[model samples]
Target: MRRVIKNDDSEVKKSNLGYIEGNSNNNLKISKILYKEQKGFCIYTEEYLGRADARDIEHFDPTLKGTSDDSYSNWFLVKHQWNKEKSSKWADYQPVLHPTASDFNERIVYDDGDYRVSELDDQEAINLIKLLKLDDIILADERKKYIQRKAKELSIYGVSPEDFFKILIDDDIKQISYLRAIHEEFKIDIWNLLPNPQ
Candidate 1:
């Protein structure tokens, strides 16, 4: 999954904490903001949220749900089903990468349709992959479909590495999914081509 650079404090003002904490209306507003900030992909699954997708505001650290830690930094918009699958299962180990805190691409390697910890052999990264089922057969199959489609598109354009880089940056994919896999399959350092995280 890509590193998620959280939005600044302006949109989720501290003054609205009461409303944000309990109001469904406020939560929807916040979810929309997060969806835009995250480029319409779930932080955990890295799946695009299509019009029919069910999503909600997820507390990254489930244990902190009702505590004072319930704030934007701990919040993300995730697909509803994945959120249910994650339901406080790894709260004690806390292995999942913090979307905004960790440099994801550095800690985890994404290949064809699988994920593994990078050469760093980060145990936490490995745990995160298993905890989230990032490489489950169903998910991998979906990723492979997108990967093949993008590969075909690139092939159609007869792109070299430089040309591919330009195309990736110039026409940013509206649904950013399996990006690391695409980069690895293409033998390109796609992360370098992207601007520094905000």
Candidate 2:
């Protein structure tokens, strides 16, 4: 998972719905803030969340335990499936990387479609990948497909290697962070020379 840059200026507050959400889907006050902060992606998986995927309000720390509704500090936006997988393991494993940390991108490296801890020996990275199954077959395949597609377009269009790297680092394509990391670690140069996507 990438380090999620959570905004300090959150609008959610401690409320009665600490145990679970209420019926009115439109009134998820805190979740609205998190959704905005997360930019419509699962904070854990770093995957885009579309309409068909169920969104879940994940408590980084188990709220059911002694923790009160101070969820603003201990919450995460995850998918329902992932949230279930992370169920009740509050203190069981301390993740090596965190959504709050700003250096997670540089700490963890992605090669092709596999994610592993960097030379820093970030065990939490290992724990998270193992526990969350970040390398699931389909997920890995998708990651590979994404990089291949980008690499193909860059090469096919006769985009200079400089331009390829430039696009990877372009601020307009912040979504390419992970894919860029893959390119860096793999040195993948295959391209299919196609026009840019509209």
**Model 1: lowest-lDDT 10 consecutive positions:** 189-198
Q: How many backbone clashes does candidate 1 have?
A: 0
* TM-score (C-alpha, index-matched) for candidate 1: 0.76
Report the number of clashing residue pairs per model.
0, 6
**Tens-digit per-residue lDDT, 155-197, candidate 1:** 8888685576567656764445665576677777654554432
Which number leads on TM-score? 1
- What is candidate 2's lDDT per residue for 1-198, written digit by digit as tens? 555655555555434334344644634655666676666567766665656778887766554433554556667778899888777554666743554666766666665567677764777776666666766777777777776776687778687755675565453434343433343644543121112221
Instruction: Report the lDDT of model 1 for residue 48.
Output: 61
- Regions more than 4 Å wrong, model 1: 14-22, 119-121, 159-176, 183-198
TM-score of each: 0.76, 0.65
